[model samples]
Target: MGWAVARFDFSWGDAEYHQETLENLKAAIKSTKKLCAVMLDTVGPELQVVNKSEKAITLKADDKVILTPNQGQEATSEVLPINFAGLSKAVKQGDTIFIGQYLFTGSETTSVWLEVDEVKSEDVVCVIKNSATLAGSLFTLHASQIHIDLPTLSNEDKQAIMTWGVQNKIDFISLSYTRHAEDVREAREFLSKLGDLSQTQIFAKIENVEGLTHFDEILQEADGIILSRGNLGIDLPPEKVFLFQKSAVYKCNMAGKPAVVTRVVDSMTDNLRPTRAEATDVANAVLDGCDAILLGAETLRGLYPIETISTIGKICAEAEKVSNQDQYFKKTVKYVGEPMSHLESIASSAVRAAIKVKATVIICFTSSGRAARLIAKYRPTMPVLSVVIPRLKTNQLKWSFTGAFEARQSLIVRGLFPLLADPRHPAESTNATNESVLKVALDHGKASGVIKSHDRVVVCQKVGDASVVKIIELED
Candidate 1:
């Protein structure tokens, strides 16, 4: 079955309560055999800062700030307490301090302005930088989304996000309301600078008209795209949004990039059940070749989060069974170009071989998940088992294909010995060859002691510079 991510949106206050909520949601989802990832929505550019001083004043790192207007506007700047001596140097006569994007200014009253020299202390009012704290909280929750608003992002904050992803080992970073190719490039460059681009994948959210126009360029840098229909619909006409959604999905498939269709798929965000239209919308997206679909309020803070996920899974599975996989393959295949690397060629060949032999399963041995990602780009029909030594690597494979199954390296080796011992197996065996690693995977779970002997399997592995594909038979 395909993997789906559960997205959560939070403000600053929700930070302390996130862990408990996450644990509850995780347990509920596990009961239904569904897996979910966390998406943390950071502060956006809705805040503005204002300075009330007649003379230019410098704000330092140390300041005790009280935000006066905190109802509608949220804080985006980090809060730092200031000592009396440092505060004296940072503020001048008739100076006001502003902290957030919402234009909140700290100004001395006219009466206070007259007595500036007599004032012993002053208050530096500013909005709090709650995005990072929220992210840090959700990181403890092990979320799937792990999203942050980029327009309001500072260089230092950007590095912090990348560092967090590397340290905690997050799978996907969703950029909110992305508009241009430069946005994607900047994010990629920042992650690369921090040595994190290889491990943490980026999912760019196309939420505006500009993002749609520059879709190709954006996709070139992004590992995946998220069709955030809610924001897109808000930005454009409804009819235009519909057309754009289809075009975007098609383009993403053509570019060999995974796209997730997200929004209020089910109007049941407040209710306990979804409407008929919601169900059809999800099914249609599945038929339209969406690699995955996202659940927003429906699975995040909705009343029936678990039920919503289960319903989505059921609908996607049914749609996939009847949907034309060949059509998707044919449409996407023409878009594939010359192989960029040896691993790319191997992955392409593996897909071609799967189709050639009508293989039931495609097994992959990977350390970095690159090998599996390349194969998934081809969108094969059979299930893909990504066998890795580290369990965390298996978690990272969630972004690639739907049917990723993880197996211990030792179990993989044990399952192959019997197949290598037997010569009468139906499929060709490459056990004697130096590329025996390929042979072991194809024969997994075929031995009598560890696994049932009557199982048949196919395995693919990267040997030397090429990915070797082999088929094997089991003996009892």
Candidate 2:
């Protein structure tokens, strides 16, 4: 299903709560005989409105509001307590501050828009529009075309990653509200310092103008890219979010990184079915060649979680039917620099050989999961079985981290099925030969029912110091 990647959001709950939920989710996946990867989303830094009491405040259009910074009191209709020191610095007269989660497409009944009328030493006075109820909440603050001086990585975010992520060995860590390349760099560097527990991959979430401005540099540091259209709408004009998504996805493709689009099926959170617009949005994103579609509240707290997954999955499949992979492949390859690296050359050749032969599947053995990522960049129609051949950790216990972590990391890429090699299998002995390794991979395919007898499969592997692509028909 489109539920291959499961996200545990620190944005909503603490890591401890997420850990328990994760275990339960894993058990569910195990019971259903399904595969899913984990993505731990950092809460990052945010501005929120605090209230003196847990009660909703009624506000109408033309209502006067005062936004005070960090005074330790709850918000009222006349005064809103925002928990940020630099709020006044970024917001000024005539500036618009939108509240609520994903309020880009402001509904007359729900979205809250405020125009700053005056900036004072203690607070900023504003006027409200689009009549909506205000409440004691952790709402997102926005100042379009302006960069708020929020920390690149908040302490809470660091605590989550360094503690929960390291303990569980997360597959992907999506940096929230990433503003620049430095944000990604800092997170990765922190991860690396955690010794062998740093097997995680970082995905930069581009949601604002600052991130969009530094997209090139961020892409270089991030293992993948997440186009957060909801937040993008809040940062730019809602109508222009599509332009950002299209451009960002295309750029990620050319750069050979997986691009994941989020919030494509948000309406399913409360409704029994996705709206027609949401359905079309999913199809269009798939057609745009996104590697995956990420759901937020749809699966986190939505009532029709299963149905949403099923519906989006079907939409993605239908979109793929009419997609021009051949055209996309050419465009992707043409951007590669001359004298391609050894790994790139092998990856491109393998993809072309698979397509030309019309192979049923493409199987490759990878140590770092790089081979699978490169093949995914080519967007092959057939599934690519990326068998993760793990490395021996030098630690005292010698427990391998690459096998499972790398496998999970590869699953988010489109058309790639990452499977960890059965370390206990006799054929996977430390001193095994290439033939034995190939035998184990083929046996895995057979056991998983991915390959049938007499099926033609493309095999990409290394021989001594060189890589080769071979086409072979499985024997009965």
Candidate 3:
């Protein structure tokens, strides 16, 4: 079964080649059909130099900076700053910098363009080392960035992120530390202008009191919500975090949007194990009907990243066993009873017919996974096999339902053609070319091969310009 898991802290700096790492991650997701989206945290945008002294730094482009602090401290190395000067050889006022995997620009301030080449790597090592310590709390296993600020969101930054997301076929965009409804609107409009807002959803993080008050409005505009309880607890009374979490989850569920509960469920970033309280916290969040969960330091920089994911998965599975699945399913299913178009009506009818005929499998050929998803939305008892050409669609579908399966185009078309075309097929009448496809489906045990001569099978496909739904019977 395809299940969506979002990789929260997928850093390009940590990997050798950022683009290659992303491609490999995409490939892994495609193979497993499990990873729903890669939520890349814009490290530079969120990174701020809290303390900078008047020190000249002289370093050539691509030169490495190694910081060795005074008196028995560890040394850390950061890649030399990449700027317009390094890339294009000539720096400009509004040009952006693409260094390694990070992007910086002078749009926010001209001072950003000033070269600090004279400052030796060791002279400013104290500042660099201490900045890590200052930012350490935010990197903790349960830490969420609450009051963090981005230097600025320029059009170039927005377009860059959006283009990458669209090209990667990401299902959701999680705006870190979302504060207002306008922020949600701005993201929506940007994606809309890019003409890639169909199935791509935008999730807003509510991390403060002001965001909490306007949560409903934000939910109305956004596709989903993430409750960053750690930073949220900073603004409100610590004891109130649980209450606020419940409220956010309830609101998201009410609005039919997915909500993710994040924070230190396992305060074992440095340690190899989770505390008893952390286990309970994870179990409680699952009981609260969170569609997904996010792990920060635990999964990123933790000593036991794999273990953290496994433990959380176990807790969620166990909680789901005892939780009210029926209630959750009923609440989450959103169907517009009245079909708005011919294709939609046909899709809806095919699902009903499949259910009525007690089909063992609902096989669908789709380019976008839309038809299969629509059928899955009805919560049919049968498994749905979604055949598509795009690997991203296959991966994205994993989050939608547990019974959905995906097959490549070659497997669905070429490999199955002979079985589908056999004349003595019992799965359905061999009248149409696509009906033969059902023979291959039945041969593979996706559908029952032995059916009474009068038994009906519903076939749905888009032939040329028209979407057709035909009910066929077994040929004796």
Candidate 4:
């Protein structure tokens, strides 16, 4: 007699809060399992100054502003209370200050741009380069040979990682404003201390010049990279943003890491549908071979969050249908490190085998999610279903996909679906055997209409001390 097979199940109630937006989100994920991810935004402990005045503060050809370290301080027409301490010590007379690419050069400068005429311990006076306004916007100080040392992870970020992340078993944690490889390492170390490194994967947000400069190094340490264009546009030249995003996504693929293009639909925040430009932007990212397209403000705070996700998913699926599969795989293949190369070879073989045999699906039983990601990196035509063990990893993978190794690192990669594999009969071993788990995966796929009787299935799993790949003919 054949052994009893386990199955994978997802409860809408336990998935997340019950709401129209969330329900729609779950349906979207179910439809686009391999290409979608849900990101929960969090505000870090870092504080910035905001204008207390409701009105915009316009600066003409010349305007003097005060930089005070007063919290909740009111702003006047001439004095702007900035809460950054040591600002006067860090900036000099010729230093340039930028508010969303608006330049304000120092007074000792030669150009007619905004010049800092005077620098006090707590205040700096500047002459505006042109008529500009500071209406509660984020600003950055740019100076030659100037370095700003900020915390890698803020206190609030730490608290959230330990509290919300641990409690919910989130699949991936995206570190915002990551400046260096050290930042990624620091975040991993923090997660390690919190006992989350094994289950929660980390994604580095490459948004600024500094992060982009050290992207390769950061990519080596991070599970994936999120190309955040909104923040990149703030500091980088507008014309170079798209080029950088495309280049970054290509590089990540070459490195065998998932790369996500983000903030493609900023205009959909208020509109019921995406603008023509926004729709085109998303389709272009998909054509660029991005593993995933991320929606930020448009899906989180936007009036039509469900519509935004639904629209983006449809666009991505359509783009994928028309994309050149052979070219996509060729672009992603390049020289990689030892273990990665080995795993990539395994995944590549599975894809080839499935295609040759006309398999319906590729089923992977993963403890750390590597087996699943390796398969996804190949961008196979058949849907890859990951039977992730450890109930925590299952729940976490729902958000993206994680354990002994970094969890759910391949959550957003193309053509990968993660499911929790639960055995009805609990065994003593911490890890389940490959044969038993494969049975579970097959059973779940059939019950979910992903597989039919006599369907060909490609199975990939890591057995004790060795990796196993097999082709199985299912029966009723």
Candidate 5:
């Protein structure tokens, strides 16, 4: 994870600060001087407090409260309303509910706990188990050992995608609580309906048991995966999250898709330094070949956002130095079938050739960014320079966002430098001579200090129906 990824969780606060925070982060670059990727996290079927009274309700242990499945109801100690309409049916008697953040271990009051006492026709009776101040019109709810029956895309989620997400031209959208491939498809189809908005990549946030069960299909449909350990810990046994993350990441590595691991440094949200366990967690993710690591509360509401990023970034770099990428590549080859696809064959060759020749960089000219992504899957030591030419339909205008957006979307993938390029000479079709593409890629590499005179490089591109791979030495 060279550059950072900023994820906006829509479940907590109003949308007013989203645009401003987005602009600030878009302008902000990492120590590597690369722009970060922005991801919009939807407020998917999760339940929330609907304290319309705009006042905090103070609750003490053993206090009784009634939960109603109504929106915008005034909050009181006697009766509390949640945004979800199916609360009564979702939880049964004796079910435990945790409200707010996940920073608690034991005897901590980071969250308000409730126990369901009775389920009436339209209300749920509960008793507070701890003393905490409940915010007005805010706070997310999670029921232990219960699956909240809900759709993939909630009404609020759909509205956010079309309005805030589309208008902001975000680089990524992560569908929360993705149960299956169809759920991923539904989000993609909804974004596609917005026309140009479809440029954004959709990632599935695997949080629930259903999502973990159907990860294979979801992986195929999603552009990437976000291992939401924070939420998964709540949905499943805390111990199982560790195993699922490993399995999910290994699958993503073989598939050559970006996989992001989140909440690796949760303790850093409160402490300036990460706990020893947290530090090891960050290193293990990098050694496991995770494409990126996401910092949830560590950056969202942390005391030291900059320090937290620096700490994780340094850990990733150090771990990468000792990582056995060649072993991973060899393991991956065992999984690939005979007679590889054109893209896969060429990409694998590009990486191997780069390593064999001690190439300073690997360059790829792609229209869909597939070649670059595949090359990254091989985990070559050198970075991949991907010159992507965006494919536009007849009605769309030719502009920066077209090709640039596609390039930016590639930022999340490991070891890829995406650039939008126009061939020196072009015909009616988007395809250009290999020479023209090479010029743009080398020019970028040279300008970025990644290439210099006499440097060796591996180049790859599509030629007609086939693919081409070559090792070339740069000249003045």
Candidate 6:
């Protein structure tokens, strides 16, 4: 039995090109079953001002500015109405404020930088430090003791999830600005109310100081953690952000949860090609053992989204190719789920066997996708084929391939690939045969070209009588 390929058209208005790419991708998968899933990044609840200007207003250094609690009001050098009313009280004298279009130009000119001079009941006075265009953009309040009560899920965020995410079968939801485990719990609770808990996984985006402070607790509930470098840089110094990224990825790897590094190629948003620094950034994230790198505005609203994807994909693939296996495997990862100990152990042993035999692939038969996650935690060198049976889980896993939830679930983990297959197919499985899994793997392996005639393959499953894992030799 063959699964129908789900296709999505990007917002770039290249429908014909999109269709052709989809057809080509499907054809390749039909013949070789090897496919990389690409996920589109959706806008989440990242706070920004609602600009009412037709164009951005440029502000020079020393220009006086006003932070107000109104919206749809034009922003000028003298006065700017901000959407967030709390901003006036959340900042103090000598505080730094960053306002902008969320572009990581690394140039202070893209965003207005200000030093707060005084605070009023509903307004704050500031003098511009840099020349920048003040438009509809979010600002970062740089103060040690300031508190901003940003909601975990904004109304817009909820609407987007209910419509775009659920209706389109989005695989992973990355919760932006997650402050604590409670925030994750709230999102899950909200999704559960919408009856979408099982359909999509939640990835907590660790961006701010609070998120960093409660990182450990947050991981317990988060399917994955996305190190949001852009916003993180605002909260912490760039050097510290990089350090935290490495540290967070290490923790995620150790816990067996997927860790993603986002904004690795922010410069790609404007340039057709990546800068030397951007290229090195992507490679370094991979070298640091991140499961995936996220392309933010580079793909969301960039000039060359497809090219950016191709470029980053090549960088990651090459980096992994030459990555040090010793460094990759030289970690003592503790399993995240306590109840999954037995299954985790089984997964561990299977990874070891695959390495010992230098197996070309590891095929896992799963119902709830747990086995796939367990095996992925081990970070095997060879490709992984997680054969899922449930229809919803299958669709969800397909979304994961798209990097929809790069931090938590991804097709970029080493060589992991997930697919939907029937355990009851006559050519691959049957009620009369207890070798359903073996036959399924053989058929899928051959079709995907990952397994060929006489190729060594490792199969992992928990069928009635089959070993959790075993070495198998393919035959023509």
Highest lDDT against the true fold, candidate: 2
Q: TM-score: which candidate is best?
A: 2
Model 2, global lDDT: 0.81
User: What are the lDDT scores of the predictions, listed in order?
Assistant: 0.51, 0.81, 0.50, 0.64, 0.79, 0.67
Query: What TM-score does candidate 2 get on C-alpha atoms?
Result: 0.94
Model 1 segments more than 4 A misplaced: 1-14, 19-40, 46-167, 193-198, 337-341, 389-456, 474-476
Clashes of each: 21, 3, 10, 12, 0, 6
lDDT tens string, model 6, 400-432?
A: 222223222435455567665543442124334
Runs in model 3 lying further than 4 Å from the true structure: 1-3, 6-20, 30-36, 42-156, 162-169, 195-199, 329-476
Rank the models by TM-score, top first.
Answer: 2, 5, 6, 4, 1, 3
Q: Which segments of model 2 are wrong by more than 4 Å?
A: 102-106, 396-401, 424-433, 443-450
Using TM-score as the measure, name the better of candidate 4 and candidate 5.
Answer: 5
State every prediction's TM-score relative to the real structure: 0.62, 0.94, 0.55, 0.75, 0.89, 0.83
Q: What TM-score would you give candidate 4 relative to the actual structure?
A: 0.75
> Which pairs of residues collide in candidate 3?
56-118, 56-119, 57-116, 57-117, 57-118, 57-119, 58-117, 58-118, 58-119, 420-436
lDDT of 2 by residue, 1-476 (tens): 45788888887767779889989978988898767888888767666676658687777899888888865766777887877878788877888887765323345555588898999896888899768875435556666667778776788888887788878777888898898888988888888898744778899988788899999999998989998877787778778889888989998888778999988776788888888998998999988889998887677778898898899889989999899988888877888867998888899899999899888889888878888889988998788999888766667756654477788888788888877775654223433655677777778788878788988899898766668799998888
Candidate 3 C-alpha lDDT tens digits along 1-476:
12244543333243334456578767886796442445544322332221132133233333434222232323223432221111222222232211110111111221121222333433321112111111111111111223323322345446546666566555556776577788778777776676444455667877667678788888999767888765575457668889989988877655545678877554667677778888888888868867677876565567887777777878876775677644544444443434345655665567677766765455665554556545544434445555432222234535222112222111111101111223233222224645555565545542335344555556666666667666665555
Model 4 ranges off by over 4 Å: 1-47, 52-67, 89-118, 126-147, 196-198, 333-341, 391-410, 423-439, 447-449, 452-455, 473-476
Return whichever of 3 and 5 wins on TM-score: 5
The better candidate by lDDT, 5 or 6, is 5
Per-candidate RMSD, Å: 13.2, 2.2, 12.7, 8.4, 3.2, 6.0
State in Å the error of residue 444, model 4: 3.3
